[model samples]
Target: MPKWPDDDVILFDGVCIFCSRWVRFIAKRDTAKRFRFTPIQSDYGARLARTFGIDPNDPDTNAVVHRGEAFLQSDAALTVLSHLPGWSWTRALLAVPKPLRNAVYGLIARNRYRIFGKYDACFVPDADLRARVIE
Candidate 1:
C-alpha cells in the first residue's frame, strides 16, 4: 500500500471549480500550515482515494486523511474546518446528525459540476500555494 503523510491531507477534485475554491480557502485560512492537499487526479491522490473506498474516477465526496484515518463527506469538511483557526466551531455541525449532514453534502457534491462548473484541466495552485500541494 502507498504510505500517507504524517500531516493532515485533503484530497479534492481538482477539476471542480467549487472544490478548487475550497482548497484555496483552506490554504489561506490555515495560518498554522497544518494541512496539505492532493488533487484526486494525481497518482498519489488516486491511491489514497481507493484506499479509503472513494472512487477516484467519479468521486462523489472529498476526503481528509488525518492521523492514519480517513474522513469522508461532511465529516471530512468539518474535520478540515476544525483545524483552521477560529473555525473550530464548525465541529458543532456534528451535533446536527451525520445522515442529515451527509445528505446535504451529497446534494452539493453530486451537483457540484452543474452548479459550480468544472475546469477542462485540473486546477494548478499559484506559486504561493504550491508548496502545500502533494503531487
Candidate 2:
C-alpha cells in the first residue's frame, strides 16, 4: 500500500521527460503535504491503471485516482492542479474540450524530451518529500 494517503495519489509516466519534470514541480510546492505520486511504470501504478481501465502501454494516458474514481490524461492533469495552491486557478483549463487540451498536451509530450529534458532514473524525494512519492 502507498504510504501517502490513497485519495491524494497521482500516478505518472516515470520515463517521460514531461512527467519527470512535473514530479519535481509538484514536489516543490505541495506545502500542505496533500498529494502523493508514483510512476505508471511501477507495479502499483500498473495495478491502479488496470483498476481504472487505463491502457498500461499508452504513454499519452496519465491517471489520477481520487476516492476510487479516476481521471485521465488532460483530466488527470487538471485534477491534480485543482488541488495545488497557486496552480489551482488553472483548473479552468479543464473546461476546454478534452481533444483540444490533449492535442496541445500531446504536442508537448511528443517533443518533451527535445523541448524539456529527461532523467536516467525515477526521482527519489528527499527526507521531507519522500512521503509525497507514495512508494
Candidate 3:
C-alpha cells in the first residue's frame, strides 16, 4: 500500500525510451486533468517508488497510485485506461486476466530499452508540464 494519493500519480522510468513516449502520450489525453507523472529517477519519483517497494535506480515498468495502493505493470496500464475517457470500455474488458496480462507486459518491459530505445538521462519536465508533476 501507499500513502493516500489526492490525485492519480504515475511512477515511471524517466530515462526509458518507451516510458518517455507514454508520458507524452498520456499528457496529450489528459483532457479531464486527472493524472500526474514523475520519473522513477527523480527525487520525487524515487521517494514514492520506495514507499511501494520499487527500486528507483531500476524499475520494471510504470506504476500507478490511487487511494493508498500502488498498481504495477499491466494493472497500472488498465487503471490508466479506465480513467482516461477514450479507453474506459477497453479497460473493463482487459481486466479479465491478470496473469496473462502481466506476462505480455513483462515481455515488453524486459525488452523495452532495446526495442524502444533509451535516454542517457531522465526526462526533464518542461515549463508547461511542470505543474502536472508533484514535487
Pick the lDDT winner. 1
Candidate lDDT values, in order: 0.91, 0.74, 0.82
Residue lDDT tens for model 1, 1-135: 344555599999999999999999999999988889999999988988998888999999999988878889999999999989999899898899999999999999999999999999899899978999888
The regions of model 1 sitting more than 4 angstroms off are 1-5
* lDDT score for residue 33 of model 1: 85
How does each model score on TM-score? 0.95, 0.80, 0.90
Model 2 is weakest, by summed lDDT over 10 consecutive residues, at 1-10
Model 2 residue 90 CA deviation (Å) reads 1.4
lDDT of 2: 0.74
Q: In candidate 2, residue 109 scores what lDDT?
A: 66
For residues 12-70, write the lDDT of model 2, one tens digit per residue.
87777778778778777777877678787788887777777666667667777766577
Report RMSD for candidate 2. Answer: 3.8
- CA shift at 113, candidate 2, in angstroms? 3.2
Q: Name the lDDT of candidate 3.
A: 0.82
